[model samples]
Target: MDHKQSQIQEAEHAKRSYGSLLNVISKQYGSRDTQYADFSGECYKAVLEECYKKAKIDPSEVCYVEADGCASMITDAMELNSISEVMCKNRKTPLPIGCIKSNIGHTEAASSLVSIAKAVIALRSGIIPPNMHYDSPNPNVPALLNGVLQVVTEPTPLTGNIVGVSSIGMSGTYCHAIIKQNPKVKPTKEPASPIDFPWLVPLSGRVELALNTVFEKIEAMPFDEEFIALAHSIFKTEIKQHLFRGYTLLNAGQQRVHEVKPYDGAEKRPIWFLFSGMGSQWTRMGVDLLRLPTFAKAIRLCHDVLLPKGVNLLEILYSDDPNVYASSILHSFVGIAAIQIGLVDVLKELGVEPDGLVGHSVGELGCAYADGCFTAEQMILSAYARGRASVEATLIKGMMAAYVLKDVINFLGLGYNQIKDQLPPEIEVACHNSEFSCTLSGPVEDMKKYIDTLKQKGIFAKLVNVANIAYHSKFIKPAAPALLKYLKQVIPEPKPRSKRWVSSSIPEALWDSELAKYSSAEYHTNNLLSSVLFEEASAHIPAKAIVIEIAPHGLLQSIVKKSLSKCTNIPLINRFEKDTLKHLFQAIGKMYLGGIDVNIGNLYPKVDYPVSRNVPALHNLLTWDNVKGELISSFMKNKKEGSVIHSWDFIKIYDKRIQNFLGYKINNMEVIPPTVHLVS
Candidate 1:
């Protein structure tokens, strides 16, 4: 995360990097500092020797030198280049030395700092800066005469990892530090996060008001090129999360950030996992999630497996090319299954296992994995087979016109048993989501006719735009044989289910039976041909459970909340959100508040920002600056201008006793001070 570039954006960098430590170093010293100079030659040698020993490198590897260039650093006197040659005997060419003081002037106290800073820049850029105003080297210098030292009068390439820095103090305190090149890679033009997505900065405060106020402040500031770097700073969560927390959503497209209401939702409750099925799959569902490495890896794993089977899950889940998810039944099934696996992997990475679990319809594929019944590959391949088998019914042309999952407003559901006799026999309940909520699937024309009939009677119903295949119905019976055959071949045999795994498709009465066992092909075939008993499944959720919907988008949130009214329901993804990645983080924050031990570090990218040690303040130096005088001047100016005279009045009061005494003592005497005016 270091932004110290040697050049390129010179104008911008100049403002921030132009300043250096002036007070920490000693000021310029003249002939009186002969004592400090006496040890200069010895000091340089010791620093060089100590650096080589510490780094375990030879003198030949020290190719660049940042010299202090003070009065006596290279004096010709008794100090010998022949002595230096003996120390650096392995050198092929003279040591290239550059003077920073030639350009920035001798910062006596800060000379060593200036030298090191220049050396660091040189090491990073791999090129030494040219010494300014160097007409010729002094002929008296022993190193210059013996060719032991080469003054870098022109720009030169720095070829080694280590560079030596020398600084001489006026107080006889010689200090030296080494500058080693950092081999770390830096961010290029393309950042890890895509430009189209918004940057959500999760914020926390000790008090609720602070979160909102800080969000408002963030929104008021101007945005520019460095905003992504700002995202890195905001992503740092080491600061203790306080009682109140929230996030500010920033999109590069917008000039200002969108503020969200702050909350103290970390109320601590048991976390339950609920996986949503088919209708939740949307085109490009994985576009934002792919940015999450843990999630993307799972998706890629599934993609690599499913791609060879003529089903491209990556395109299905992340492409909005002419609604591939809706038109192709295979894409729909594979996309939902692939996204579910990714979501499960991300949840595990977050370190929150389901205290309780339920999966609706196709979501059962993900549920089986979460319950340890199916591995990542088995889940993905099972979904591929389910969709591949669904091709058997493609020509039949049927669709599911459900009462829910298309949107939140049509939250009402049908109790399948209650309405069993009312509908045409061709139309059957596909899913019983809640006490009054369910999905109805039938032939495409019949489904539309039924919905239109309801519409004429002023009842609202809409087509599930994401799904055109009539799943979980008699219409899907044609694909059952193929589905079962493929599933049996793919899964081979069912694994033992976890006790915490609740059944959404299988009723609670059959939970103890082989039906809840998800016994390979038969269970999946039966699941497709029968309605989802989600209401029966949610019965097993704990009274205080905090439910999280695991899918590319949310569909069963309303049903979960209604069934487990006492529990908290947090849908991890929203199809309508600007950035699903941000939505996932907010969901994790909710789970964290609900007592789930989520790994907070997993939510953000790894970052390492360089830090500097604290030093004495620059106020130690004497200056012509007068702050108090300016403050008083400002105060007087404001006081003079920022005032108004509202009203003025004069009051004359006579003291009866004094007036009487004066009038009696001296006749014709008027005891009055001349025009006395009092200003208060």
Candidate 2:
């Protein structure tokens, strides 16, 4: 009755606030105080008869009726009207009238909401609960005395969409709310279109064991339309006590869990993209990614730009044939460029962006394209011309090997001039990879001899497992001019003069004159001849930056990890892993942990599955606060031990206090006393 009165008071306030915009009308009455005269039971019956006549709906349309059963008189009056509405329809089933108060006692101010909630549940579930009391009808009521209505004695199965609930205050403030299940709302049981790729499901638990339980429950269930919809509905929420964070990827073949270490005390830092060069390519580097339209489109774009030169890049990428890698270096280099570009597109979609970028050898071409220095067509042409030069130099029978120096010896313990004099003319220091490591290039026999000499001194050395011609050495210097000449014809446009570039060829700090020289053909020719200053360029990277290797494998990441002082290495792709989809998602999950915001909607470009629009079940967990005493308080003040609580309820409670303090109270009592002092 108090709830009904509060609704009346709110409606009255709305009338004063909005003037003519408010439309208030009196409805049927039902209440716990069953005295017919006090709660106006006759008005309730009149409204029900009038509604049935006006809407032309018989009582048979309503499967069940929930009445405010604070007393027998209130329920008996609603039952009488049900019979009057169905008199002309010849309906056989008596409308099952139930009262929530019979089962769960009167809930005071929550009585009306509870009764309405029960009615909605009954309509959805098709079962009407029995009125616990009143095995015999009230003989005083006209409906029972005349045999016009019957009381439901037990649980009954109902078969209709409409249900009705009523509540009335003691002073005759009557309310009636009719609930009708809309025919347009579809069932969630229907099968949806299959997802061709893996879907990520974010899970959160208060403890480590809770996470294991969550995973076990998911593993036991079949992957279905509802599961897919639930997976895509993940959202961010505040963590409470000891959160176990990570996500699982669901696919047709198998499921994989990518566990993120529970967040430690750390701050968000910047990130860098480290793109890969040649020798990272395998036969089918991007075969698994072909299902994605964005990736496939990027591959098609490369094919279109290079097919005129008689190369089909997709045939090699999608084919399992071992000869694909053996045929030509042009195909492999072009595939690397195409895959990296496609990866950049997908990363942007996932909301993981790089603050800066660095690339190795031909990998810099993709970086150049990303920063607007090279267009897609120009990048393809440049890769092809460089690969052609490399294939020509293979005839010289020279290769590159990486070596780590022992004891930080200066030029092998001899003076620079003496060491240069003793060394063979064919051997050259190809790469200053780091402070401790360098790559050497020469004829195969000279490389073997140098390795033997270094091993005799207890220095670590190994031959790089690549079949390419020796880069950054004099042996390939003859191939540079022709490659540079072709690049100039194919790319005649002027440079954009982007300052984001970091050169691997020059070891000095880049000046404006040097930046402009990147546009000239001689600059590129010199790049092919001179050693790569990778260690020098790495020094330019800012402090606390994270390096993400964008490649088919983690080959460059290991080198970068050893070179940098205090930086983290994240690999976007892994050639060693067989499940490419799971590996890619793990990289994304790690980025999220590193404080990057991911827009999950972009991950689903094709929304044929009709994902559920509902918000996730787990929400912001409660926190401790000191209110009146030293006792701990959660964000949910009225929450009990095992009941679900809502944030909107908390908001409503505070809103009422604010309203009382602002002088909107029914009584003159002040919420904030004048004698009490308040702190802001």
Candidate 3:
């Protein structure tokens, strides 16, 4: 042969050897053959006829043939032709034939042998191998192959009758046959028992050498209980060593081991309720509250509707005008407007809500709404009036600062009596945040004096860096008269109390009498003039109450926890936890359905695995110029020789190149190339 021809021959020889090896492995693993391009219909018929003759079986007497490896080629062609011929001639009585090759790939050299073996085993066990990977045949191939052969792809009982198997090789070089009936094996009976020795010796250890002086000799034992016990002893020793190693590793500083306490079943579990609040709002407040269907309808039913009185509630709350502040009205208006409007909407959404509603100052308006003392519109209007009135009242007084006091009551006691007596009539205590903290508003002189005294007493107090007037104090008392007048004329009459509702404001429970009392002008005036002692309210309800703090930030939640140690607990649920309105609704639904531990972490779909990884070499070969050309040349030559070459070989060669390029130390023998059919 010429050099080129010599190389081609070498390659072909290697390919045939590989195919042969695959066949051996397939047979060993119990694989049967189906049709392969390499084996044609004529070739299969010739081989099967030869097998029948060798087995001394007549064609008519042969009940079934479990044909493997190129077996489907003949069967398919015959079926397709027979169907067409039958339609034309109206004939019948074709021999029954089955192809196991359709289930597994062609086993090549051992193809017929494997199929015969499986058939024999099936005939003995009364089971059959399935024909797998058969969807539809190519149009170029005869359609007779499409559905002619009835190959059992699932486990099936055999009739313990005679069966036939056949294999055909390239160039009609090889064929095999087998004839078998059923043979049975009986099951063994033995009870399981524990081994006496608990320690296992490592393979590397010499028991005699380790024993040195003290050793005991044992006699030869059969492979029965004694042998099994010895094996178990060795296994146990290995396990013990492994456990020691694990313990050492765990004690190492690199590992972080947590001491987990088992759950105490007796511990009482508290009911968990997640809370949501308003979106972060700026500029305008309560404007949307007037438009809500629930709020609008409720406001209309109230006794004295305040919203229709030409009040520009939005502008008053949103504005930063010095005039509004000069009159000491901005803070109260904004606070009340935020609280009432926010609460009204929140209550409508909640319907029947938590044990207690916790608000961050302004959120108290929402609490009041839950108590049924104020309709949504009335709350918004009242807030607007409070803001305007407070701003007007605090125009001359200095700004208020939220002070963190070491002792809130002491701070309040020192200032409430003394500051009230000394400061101008315009100053006041805005909010009682906690027992130890309070916000104060007054003229600059009085504020400076109070701060100075607290500092000297070793109390840490800082001014809240805010622009609005100090609220809940005497600073806005002047505006209280006007506020009370507006509320008395415009505030809505109290609605009937609902058992489903609860208030953070009252301790016993919300009743019409209590709500009506707060709704009166006198009570409204007192609320405007005096600071809200949240510490006092918190002390009343000292049980585990669900406190939902409504605000943009967690500041209110933190304050509630610190102020109401007896009532509130940790992991305080808020609007931000739910993040979105839809999620908030879902959380509420889950809560109502009693799924307290529900968590919604991620919502995106998982990514899919890429197919390229499975056939990297083939993929690379397709993309590589040199590899592709070689593959095409090989394929074309094979076709001319009545044989087809596979692209998988090129993929394997390219994969080797890739491994070398990437500096991988993998053995070439370890690399498996994909199989493809090459017809000869």
Q: lDDT per residue, candidate 1, 407-436, as tens digits?
A: 357544456666677788788888776766
Model 3 regions more than 4 Å off: 1-352, 358-362, 392-399, 406-430, 464-470, 496-521, 540-544, 565-680
C-alpha lDDT score of every prediction, in listed order: 0.64, 0.61, 0.40
TM-score for all predictions? Answer: 0.56, 0.71, 0.38
Candidate 3 local lDDT, 106-224, one digit each (tens): 55544654565466445544556556765555343342344333345566655435455544444333343445442222223332323221111111111223221111111111112
Q: State the lDDT of candidate 2 residue by residue for 546-657, as single tens digits.
A: 7777776666765677666587677878888886756777777676555455665566644432222221112212233446575322333222332222333223435754
Which structure among the candidates has the greatest lDDT?
1
lDDT of 1: 0.64
Two-way TM-score contest, 1 vs 2, winner? 2
Displacement of the residue 343 alpha carbon in candidate 3, Å: 7.3
RMSD (Å) per prediction: 17.3, 9.3, 26.7
Backbone clashes in model 2: 1
